[model samples]
Structures are given as structure tokens and as C-alpha cells.
Target: MASPILPGSGLGSGLDIGAIVTALVNADKSAKQTQIDAATKTNTLKISGVGSLKSALTAFQTAMNNLGNKTNPAFAGFTATSSKTDILTATSDSTAVAGNYSVVVNKLATGSKIASASFAGGAASAIPSGTLKISQNGTDYNVDIPANATLQTTRDAINKAQGANGISANIVTDSTGASRLVISSSKTGAGSDLSVSGIAGLEIDGTQLMGSSPAAGASGAVNGVAQNAELTIDGLAVTSKSNTVTGAVSGLTLNLVTVSPGTPPTPAIVGVEANTKGLQTSVQAFVDAYNTLKNTIDTLSKATPDEDGKLTVQAAFTGDALPRSMIADIRAQLTAPGAGGPLAVLSQLGVMTDRLTGNLTFDTAAFNKTMAQPGMTGQVQQLFTGTNDTNGLLARMSKAVDPYLKPMDSKSKGLLDQRLDSLIANTKTLTNQQLALDLRVANLTKTLTAKYNAMDLLVGQMKATANNITSFFASLNAQQSAK
Candidate 1:
């Protein structure tokens, strides 16, 4: 006998096999899927929290690093000012000493400028073009001019000649309506005087361009002269070809503005004073950065209080000990006594901490008073930037924080970075588990569907046999009654 053929779902027994299989699969998957979803959400929140903590810690570290550098402008304890800005303006770096100096501006530096003699054809006039020889500061340049070149064309050619010799040319119309070619030097000293030749009809007086007394001209004419800057500092005479004067005083740069000192002889009083305001500003910045880090730690590590006053571990990192330990270490370093100095502790320098929030605050008045004391600025600087001093606040704090922020070696990761990596790995594992469960559910669904379809086909065959038997019996009864 041949095997009976199985009908598809709902065809023979009116039973919905596909729906039954789907319901069973969903029932088996719902519980595991819920757990996976919860785990994934937790991992994602932890990654974000760790990232925020790392960012805050890094910012605080940067502020501490800036305070540790002695050469920074914030540590510069000097300010320089000029009494007569018209005569000169000056600036001083940290190297300057406090003192008053007598200054007199006798003459200002001048650059060389020379003009060609008037041309008969004016600016548009064509001239016999040849190689123009231009010299400045002992360097010479040869500029080739095409034939029938106008003053404008000759000027353009001179400028196009590329060389180290600083020389420039231009065509200018004098007050008398005559156009002349003017050549000047790029530098401002006596050695930068310019000279030009090679135009057949043009002549430039070399002596006049050198700033020496020029011979009388037949009519109105202007000549260029080169001269050096003359000045006196503290009764010492000084001469330079440029207006910017340096090296006369250690760490002082004088920018000469004019030769005439203002009325009443305003001699600039340049001196070094304690940069108390700058130091105070930097200290405040450090305090603010520390507060930011502290707040981040509190948010990440602290639990929320319920309505009934019970503590709940509702935060992402509430159960984690790393953030709490890191913050505790930082607080200990901040409160400890600093290295031996006049300002031995942060409180002495007007930096204090809040009892509740564990954040730092700055007292401007106290800092100003401490900085005003003699020799206290150097001591304050040493407290933060001291060399490997265990008691130094910033030094100790940096040492403690460095391990967490920086990696130990090429193969090792930072504390937070490592935590995030672990969370990511766990997330991948959860995903793989979910995929495995789904595959098992799919296979079970296939098997169950086939069995249900076979059962329905067998039931349909039994019903057909019963109907045929009943029909034969009815036919027999009807024939018997007729007899």
C-alpha cells in the first residue's frame, strides 16, 4: 500500500497550521528577547557615561598642565608701560627688571626714495629702452626694457625683475605737471639707499638719494634722503637704521613712533610689577576646571534619593567603583599640604573647596593680599610646578591622574577605554545569542508545521470512510423495507 499524501495547512482539517507555528515561535522567543534588549540598553548607557567622564578628566588635566609651565604668560610677573606713547611704545617680558629710564627721541629712521628727471613726453612718453641697473645696499639688479617703452612699461619691467635686492619703481607726476620715474628701497637704513641708471635720457643724483645735501635745482624739485634713527636711553646715545630698537635694555622692545617727545618731556617709566591679576585669573580657571570634573564624577557615581528617602542605584555607573575611587584620589591630593613655601597650601593662595559639592572656589581678596607680599609670587609658582615634589598639589595630582588618562604601553588601554571595550564585547556576545535562539525557533517551527499538516490529512481520511459506511447501510435498509 502507498502512503497517504498530507495536505497543506487549513486544506484538509480547517486547522490554521501557519498561525499555530508562528504563535509557538513567538512564545519561545519573547523572554530571551526582552533580556537582550535590556542588556543592550545598559551597555549603551555605560559607554556614553564613560565617554563623558573621560572628557571631563582630560579637560582638567589640560588646565593643570598649563599651570605647570613656568614660561607661560600667566606666570609672567611683570608689566611694562610707556609714559609718552607718541615718542615710543615699549613692552617687556618676564626677564625685565623694575626701573625708570630717561628716553629722548632725536631723529626717526628714514628710507631712500629717488625720482628721475622730468621727461619731455611726460608719463606716456616712449624712451630708448635698455637694461636698467638698480642697486640697493651693495646688491645690484639688471632689468631689461623693450625698445619704445613708456615710463609705465619701464616701471613694470623694473618691478618684474625678481631678486633679493630690495628695489621698487613707480611713475609719479610732480606738482609742476612733469612725470618722473621714482625708485625706492624696501629697507629703512642708510645702507638701504637706492641708485638707478641705464635710461639714456634719465639721470638720478646718487648723493641726493643717499640723503646728503642736494645741489640747488633750477626750479622746484624734491630729493630723497636716507637717514638713521637717533635716540638716547639713560644718557646713553643710540643709533640704528630702523625704528624698532631692542637689546638696549634686557627684555625690553622699544617701537619708536616719532622724533618729537611730547610737551613736558614725557619720559616713559618702564618697570616690572607683580602680575597679580593674571595669576589670580589662572588660579580661578584651574578651580573652574576642577569643579567641572567633580560634577561629572558625582553625576556618574552618585545614586538618586527616592521619595521615601531611600538611596537607589539609578545612575549608569552607580554600581561601578572606578569613578568613586578616581574622584576620591583627586580630592585627597587637593586637600593635602603643598611643598614647603610661603603659600604652602591652596587655601593660602585663595583656592578652597566646598564641603558639600567637593568643588573648588577662588577668593580674590585673599589671593591679592598674598601676591602683594614680597617674594611670595615665586613661592606660589614653585608650589604648582615643583620638580617631583610629593607635597606639591598640582605635581601630585598630575601624577595620580596620569595613570588613568594615559596608556601604560602600546598593548594596554586606559581605564575608561578598557571598560568601554569590555562593554562592546559583551554586546556582541548578546547579539550572537539572540541570533542562535532565533535559528532554533525557526527550525522548531518547521518541524511542528509538518506534523500538524500530516495529522489533519489522517483525520480527513477517517471522516471519508465513515461517510461511505453509513451510505451502504442506508441503501441496505431501504431494499429490505421494499421486500
Candidate 2:
């Protein structure tokens, strides 16, 4: 709230003009300064809330990352070559030797064509030969019939229609000179259904022609044209579709080069360990953020106050007690001893406490040493991962922050991420308000100084005038006495 000054409050003090103006200007300045101060305080609280939340999140992420590395055995003693891909070969011998080995196939070229297909069995009796319609994947194609259109011509038409569906079709003549039409699906799926329709003389796989009808054709004939490659990973049979097989896992790719029956193929491994490193880094980032937030809250809450009982007007915070309350709630959640929690209590984790500050002080040397223990990670994981206990520290922290972290949770904003967003927004608003108020105060101060200066000048003039009159009267009195 700003103070509003009226004209008559000892404003000019007899030399009314300058003095009154100065008083008015000073009052306005003070009011503006007050508003600016209030706005700044509000902003500070908003920033504090956001900063604290971010720090907590970072910490949680860091803890999770550390635990992940510690718990995942695959990451232990894992190393990668320069290319980050491992190409290991396995050769079979007449004498079978049993050892740990996984097959990897590196060369498989896959192309599916209508395998040994014929239209109405290439017989004139079945097709009757006018115009035939072939439909694939629910799209219709028209084929023109000439006076003497051969089965090859119809096959060629089907091949030409391949471009419509982004599928390639071609006619291949076998060694016996038997011509076959292959209608390949552009993509594989049950949805890639093919059918024959609107044909006066055409049959596909002994099915009569109808108008764009899927059911009119033989079952499994229209959609049955597909190829599959089978490979094994870690002795487990895995079947996959695409030629380039990087889609299998985060850091694995399987390229099928050959199909040799009864022989296990060589496998290629790529960049799996590198991916783990990325995850580790991500987790550490979270920890770093968490620590930052924790530090910020601790600093603000514990800062000593001004001796005046009232914070300085320029101080940027409000409710001297709110930060402490929030910190306590957060700390309680973090320090709660438990199994299946974010952390297994501060003390159990080797984090010491300072009695006077009531803060958890980390002994980096001791924590590092303890973490070196063989089962340290396992112990940490047990606390955080299982649902065996509902008192998990992560869960508890989540619960505590939930109120402030959701979007649309509160009319102001919810917690999960919304609280931070709201805080930032509030901070901006506070900054603008404070800046405006500061500018107004500056203007008011200048106006007041000018007015006061003018008033002082006028006062000096009045005193000089009074002195001159007194001297003139004294001179006249002396002259009269002489006469």
C-alpha cells in the first residue's frame, strides 16, 4: 500500500509554495519506495520457492542415477571399442564344444514378392479375358484388356500398379519358362490386405474376381505375402522385420546377413555401454539440482534477521517465518528412515547432522568410503525401489511436494512443475512492480528537492527584506534627533 499525502500537512511552513511542494514530492517518493519494497519482497519469496524445488529434484535425480549404476550388473567392468560396436565371430567345429555363445547374423537381404503367383491359374477358362481389377490395401486399379492380352500383360499391369501403393511388383520367368506374377505389399501388416475386383477375366490363386472385395479372394492369399528373419540374442530366439535392426534396444542393433540352418551366426554389439553412461549423467544432474535447491532453502531460512524486529525496507522477502516452515516439512520427508524409500534416512546414509543449525551436514570423505562397500548400492536400492514399504523417502518427498508441483492443482498453480512456473511468473510480476515503484520514487524525490530548494530561497529573500526595512527606519530616527 502506498501513502497518499494531501496538500495541508505543514507543507510549505509559511513560505508555503516551495515548502508545501517539497513535502508533497517527498511523501510521494516515500510511498513509491514502499510499494517497490513490498513488490521486491514478494518476488524474492517466489524465486526462493522455485529454486528450492529445483534443487530437490536435482538431488533426487542424482541419487537415482547413482543407484542405477550401482545396481545394474551389466555396467560393471564394461568397456567398448573405438567404434562402440563389438563384432565377435563364432565358428562351428565337427567336435561340438559347449560354452557361452550368442549367434549374430550380419547379412540378410529381405524382399517379398508375390511368391509363384498366377492369375486364375493362367487359364483362359477361368479368366474369360475382358478387363480385370486388382485391389491391394483397399485401393482400386484398373487394367485394360486388348484383343489378345496375354497373362504376361495382366501381370505387367499389376506390376505397374505397384507404384500406387509404394510397393514394387515384377514378372519373373522361371528356368522352365513358366511366367509368374509377384504382387509385393509396400508395407507389412494385416492391414495390407489385397483383393481382386471388377474383372471380367482374371483369377488370382484360383479366386473369382469381384469388385474390390477382400473376402472374395482366397484367405491368406491377399495379405499372406511377407518375409521374416529369425535371429538369436543371448541364446534367446528373437524374430525381427526390418533389414537395419538398431530398433531392438537402446544400444543394440542386429543386421541379418545370412540364414544358415543348424549353424549359429556371429553377432554384432554396438554402443550399449555408452548409453548407460548417458543415463548415469542424467541421474547426476538431478542430484546436483537437488543439492542446489537444498542449499538455497537452508541459506534463506537460517539467515539472521535485522535487530529492528522489522526487516529493512529494501530486504527482499516476506513472512520471515514461512521459509523455515517449508524447509522443515521437506527435511522431515528426506530424513525419514525407511526401507523402499528415496533415501534410507540421512543418518543411515552416513550424512551427519549439525546440532546448532539442525541441518544435515554431509561428510564427503565418510560417504565416499561407505559407498565403496560391496553391498552399499544394493542397500540403497532396497530402500528406493520396492513397494514393500510405503515409507519410501522418494515417495514421501513426492507426497510433500505434490501440493505445490501440479499444474491446475491450485487456483494459483499446482506443484509438480506448475509451482515453479508460478513462482517464476510471480517473480517477474514482482520485479516489474518494484521497478515501476522505484522509478516513481526517483521522480518524486527530484520533484521534492526542487521544491525545497525554491522554498529555502524564498525564505532568505523574506528575511533580507525585513532587515532592510529595519535599517531604513533606524537611519530616519537618527536624522530627526539631530534636527
Candidate 3:
């Protein structure tokens, strides 16, 4: 919105011809320019508003999802603590219940690590042409030994072969310049240890020691025999071939680190308890996230009036149905009953909504009292994470925001994408129209300047002619007067 008289090139008639042309062009362009400007402002506001809504909704869904994870479920998780972490450690998932146990780790399971006597000829010791047969847990893998195969090559062959899944081999050379082929099995269980044979110089007894390479009986034990994990939970015996024990105590996993045997037996006290504080924190975070989304919607779609009921201030989406409709759709989901449990609805778990603001508020004290009841911890968790059907409050809320979560550049347009695309196209069209109008104005200015300059030239020629005629008349009159 500018003044009608604008600055332009004015060289021809001193009647301010430039100003006149500018005024004419302004008069032609003003109304359309104003319309375009207003439309652009409104569309830009809508784009910004929708983009903000999308971001807020996406973040809310993320916070909600973090609480709904199955493994580390929000307030219902049972934390497992081991008193003697040096002897043993414990971990529990959502399936674990609160309980105390006296665990005694008898001995740690040891894996078989066997070594060959020695290769006095170092890593270059040659072997006989026979298959190096390696067996573990009734499964056998064979490595073809070519004639004149060196000790290092056989170890490399065993390490690289496909069928040798858990068999490891290496040449360990002592300071005496003697290399011994040390091989170990990844298997830790009692009857699952690796057994190797079928080659002459590389035949090493997995249980004992013997002579060296080219001696026919070169074998020895590096870390001795394999054993199973022996431990007791609550005085009940539990034997595992591996040190890491699972399924022995329902949902608990016990990792036997070392021996804690004898006198009072050095027992490990493991305790599983409900994480009530974690549950409370998660609920508060969920409520806060939802409230943030609600606030954004309220601010963007706000249409407030003065005391006289006259709207003096306007917002981005004021009087627009889009924001209102979106909030209504999202709000309607909270009323639907959650997928089955003792805690049937969100309000039962203290997630309540305000009557006026439509924002959620969590009643921590009330929730804590309800959770304090016997066997209500897991029941309360089921409210947000539905059983059999994933139609819980969080699930429904996530679904509501899914439409707006898509990136703007995505081809599969989101809720706000179509409107944004339309606005952008409209803005471009308006720009083109403005450019066309400017071109026309420039052309008109040039035409008007040329016409005014032509008229000025004609006026100047007439004045010159009149002056010449006047001079001639004066000369004639003077000559006559003199006669």
C-alpha cells in the first residue's frame, strides 16, 4: 500500500508527465496487488501453522511410544538386583515378578582350550597329507591337508573354513623360538567340547599333554577340561552347561561369574521389585507431551474477542475449520475404551482431561494409591498397552498423528501436504501475474513518454515559426516608417 504518485523518468513536458504515468500504473495495479498480498499472507500463515502442528504431534507420539515398549515396560518392569555382583549378576524383563532369591554359584563353566606340544621347527613345520577332522557336539567339519602343509597353513585353514563354525586356531610361539598350535572351541558346555584328529603331526589330546611335531604323539591341554555351570536358586539345584543361565527362575537370567562355594556358601541375594517411580515418570511425560500438542492447536486456531465481542486481534488459523477439525478428530480418540484389562480406561489410571482446555493432566497421588493395591502393577500397565488388541489409548493417539508425521518432501502426501502444494502453486501464479503487470506498466510508460515528447517537439516548432514571422513584420514596419 503506497501513495498514488510514484517516482518515474520525467524528461518531456514540465507538467510532471512521469508522475502522471506512475499514477496511472499504480491505479491499474493496486487492487490486484493488494489481493495477491493478502492471499499470500493467509497461505503462508496456514503453511507455518500446519508445519508446527505436524512437528508437535510427531514428538508427542515418540514420547508415548517410548513408554509402550514391551521389554522395558513403563511402571510394570521388575528390577533384578544381585548382592554379590563379583560372583554373579542378574537381569529381568517385563515377564519377571517381584521376588527374592538366595543364589549360590558353585563353579563357573569352563570351555576346552587344547594346545599341541610344540613345533621346534617353528610355524614352518610340515604335516602329513590327511584330512584334519574337527568334531563338536556330534557335528564334524573336515579340512583337506595338502602334501607338505605347514603348521601355520593348517591353523589358517581351520580358522577360515566354513563348516568350522565355533573352532578357533592360532600359532603361539614362546621366547624359545618354538611355535605351538593352540586351538579352542567356542562351545562352553560339558559334552559340546571340540575333538580334533586324523592328521599325524597335529594330533593333540584335548584332555592331556604329550610329545611334539614329527613325534606321532604331540598333544596337551592348555586350560584343561570343560565343565557345566552348577548353581542353586532358593536351595533348588540348577545345572547349566553354559555359564549364562536362562529359564531356571522363570523370567530371570543369571550370569555365573565365579565360584562362591563353602561355609554359609557365600550366597548371592537377588531381589526383583516393581519400578513404581519409572511408571509415574512415564505417565507424567505422556501427559505433558499431549498437553504440548493441545497448546499448539489452541494457539494456532485461537479466535479471541474483546470485551465488546469485537475481534481486534487475529491469529494464523483464526476462523478456519482445519485446525478445529483436526483437534476434534484427535480429541475424540481419548473417549474410546482401551483394549481389555482390569484398568479399563485412561481415567482409571489417573490420565484425565480438563473440561475447558481439552488438555490432559495426570493425578500422581491417585495413581500411586491405586497401584499400591496387591497385584495392580501389571494390571495398570495393561491400560496403555492393550492385551491381544493394540487399541490402547497410546495406540489410538499414535494413529491420530500418523497422517501428519510424513516428511513434506514425501511423495505420499500427508494431511497438510495437499494444502501446502496448492498454496505454493498459487503464490507462484501471483508472482507471474505481478511480473506481467510490471512489463505492461513499463511498456505503457515508454509509450506515454514518446507521445508527450512528440507533442512538446510540435509546440516548440510552432513557437519558433511564430517568432520568425514576428521578426519579419517588425523589419517591414521599421522600413516603412523610415520611408
lDDT of 2 by residue, 1-483 (tens): 342342333232344543465556567667656766766666666566556655565565445445434224221212222121333322211112222334554334343333333344442212335655656545666666555656666566666755665655455454444444455555543334445545542344312222233322222243234445555656566555554454443323344445533344434443322122332333344334445655665655444557886764322223455445555666676656665433355555555656875545555555455555544443443444333434544455555554544454335554435555655777677678766766675566556656665666676787778889999999999999999
lDDT of 3 by residue, 71-168 (tens): 55564546678999989988765457899999998877878777776778889988788899877677778888888899988888888883247778
Over 155-268, each residue of candidate 1 has an lDDT whose tens digit, in order, gives: 888777833456677786756566778777657866666667677755565445323333223111135467788888886898888898888888577889987556645555
Clashing pairs in 1: 211-225
Better of 1 and 3 by TM-score: 3
> In model 3, how many backbone clashes occur?
2
Candidate 3 ranges with C-alpha deviation above 4 Å: 1-12, 69-73, 87-97, 108-228, 240-246, 250-264, 303-339, 385-403, 406-438, 455-483
Off by over 4 Å in 1: 1-9, 12-16, 68-71, 75-268, 303-314, 336-338, 365-378, 387-396, 466-483
- Check candidate 3 and list the clashing pairs: 209-220, 211-218
Better of 2 and 3 by TM-score: 3
| Whole-structure CA lDDT of model 1 | 0.72
| Backbone Cα, N, C clashes tallied per candidate | 1, 35, 2
Off by over 4 Å in 2: 1-17, 20-101, 105-264, 267-289, 304-405, 409-412, 415-483
Model 1 error, position 287 (Å): 1.3
Residue 50's lDDT in candidate 2? 56
lDDT for each of the candidates?
0.72, 0.48, 0.75
In the order shown, what is each candidate's alpha-carbon RMSD? 9.5, 12.3, 6.2
TM, every model: 0.56, 0.42, 0.69
